[model samples]
Target: MAKEKLNYIHIIVTVYVLQLGVDMFRMSNMLAEDFGTNGWIAILIVSIFVVGIIYTIGLVYRLGEGKSIFEILENHLPKFMLYPFYLGVAVLWTLIGTFIGKHYIFVLQMLSFPTTSQSIFNGMLIFLAIILFSMGIYNMVKAATIFFFFTVWTIFVVAFYLPEFEFIRLTTHFFSGGDGYIKGFYRVFVTFFGFELVLLLFPYMQKNTPVFKATLIGHLLLTSAYVIASIVCFGVFSLYQLKYLLVPGLELLSYIELPFVERVESLIFNLFIGEVIVSIGFYFWGAQEMLIRLFRKHSKAKKAKKLTLALIAGIFVYSMQFDTLIQVHEMLHKLSLFHTAVIFGLPIVLLSLLFWEKRKEKKSNAKSI
Candidate 1:
């Protein structure tokens, strides 16, 4: 049977949701602390870099003829070269996803499940992600699309907090002498991290789909959302309040007073559950793709998927060793730096090799002709 193909819309929705989910929970507050009133400026600046990165990703996809990075490395490089590079990609993605998952569990522990075992929560998330992966990538996109709608209204919900925002909090000294702006820029840069999933998703997209256009739209959508969220949080809280907040976007929702719900932030957090699933699902799919490609001859084998799930579980168990939020955040910051290098640096290396290979091929063909 021929494989199913995902549309450009699926890519847009999945990437946007994945990026938005991480930023709302982990990034918005850190951004407020880093840039103070000028955080949105950092977001905008980083967005231009993001657009360039997305374009490079699309170009690399074209150069590789829509193969995932693993497939490209396999075809073009030796096993020794391939395994280490591919393994790093897989492990980095899995670790990043686990860190994000840990944050979510910690949030739940503080807000609702103080006495419940976090292991249970962690296991449940892993179980759900495996189920989603088993359904296939098409279904992952569909699930993300559904979740996109479920949680997108949270953007509108942010408007409720606007009345409390002190507009004066927007700084005139956006690029002041303090290193906070630079630090904030780096922190916010990670918020743009999830869009690199395109490197893996390229092969799954429908042949005629416009990958470039889809990614451009997706990056812009995420940029708008992040900038708005940062602005809202900066406006709502002073420097002192924002510096201490673990999840400022969630905290923003705390100020909402709806006639129906007593604790509005709780409702918002519940809605974000869908987004968490989608974000983790994207990473899981990437890790699963790399794992299967590395070990199995056939990508579609049931055994490969089972092994992938097992590996994901192992990574999750290892991540649980970092019990405290501080430890998890510190580790994530280091990983984020590494991730920036891998996602951008790996593609440039591949693209260079692809270019050299193409030139060599043209010369050989010219002689043969």
Candidate 2:
């Protein structure tokens, strides 16, 4: 049931959860460094750009009649060309899943359990993602919807910081404090990276699902979260303070002393574990879909199970190589570059192919007429 049917709500929550990830915690820090005093504006600009990309994703689904990209590309392209692209994305997505999972595990280890081995949490997460992937799109979407609620309430926690928010901290200067756009924009843009997995989601969506609109709503929801988080972060911390803080969002949470919770940040921060799992699960799903289709297997039993195990193994093995947080960030820098190309480039490629096919059909019809 790789093509398990799903509704618009599933896609909506899936997109939002997929896009948010672990980046939300450090967004203000990234923005403060990238766009400076008003670097948060990058969220708006990138939102517009990513929305356009999301539209193309919907159009590609419409044009291709909800076929999987592997199905569409395989029909129009040759095996020699097709398989490698499939394999490339499969590996790319898997690597991304690995890195993202590793990063989250590192942060959790640092926060709550300094002595606990990273491999334990990392391995458990990969195993959970493997199970999610095996459950297929319908279940994954359901799981993400639940995850969406669990983590989303934390966004409103910005309210606690309202008393301390300073308009002066936002400052009068327009984009005055950033160091460089390349690094800054990259960090901010990457926050929205996983939304591109919507391309793989086409097959699971039912006809007349209005996936286009759902994605817009979902993406806008994510943008609102980022903007609000950034605003609170800027207001609560000076530009100088933001530069040094690793996770301004968590810092916001640290100020929130609830009547029930002792470690407010810990409780809220651990909830993000759900969001990260959903994120990694989608990537692994996308990668697994490509691999399964490439082999042309009808029975998913043995093949799919084997693939899941292999991906989990790959994630663990690959993640072990990065011994330091610095190494993880360095690789994320590269992954963000690759993620940019894939999200933007996939839509362009799909559109060109569909247009070319349309032109060829018109030519043949003219001759027939």
**How do the predictions measure up, each by TM-score?**
0.91, 0.95
**1-369, model 2: which lDDT tens digit per residue?**
554578898888988999887788889888888778877888898789788888998898878777777666766877888778777887888888888898998888777988988888888988898788778778888999998999888888888777898898888886787888877766777888877888887767788788789899999999999999888888889998888999877777877787898888889879988888888888888887777766575666468557756866866787787878889999988877777787888788888788888899999999999
lDDT of 1 by residue, 1-369 (tens): 998898888888877887875456646567656655465677788889888888888888788777767666777788877767666777887788777777777887887789998878877876777677678778888998998888776777777776677878765666433337667777777877788887777778888577778988978887887777777777777766776887877777777788999888787787777777767777877877776666666545566567666767788888878988788879889999888897788778779878987999999999999
Which numbered prediction scores highest in lDDT against the true structure? 2
Clashing pairs in 1: none
lDDT by candidate, in order shown:
0.76, 0.82
Mark the 10 consecutive residues where model 2 has the least summed lDDT.
293-302
Model 2: CA > 4 A from native:
1-4, 297-301
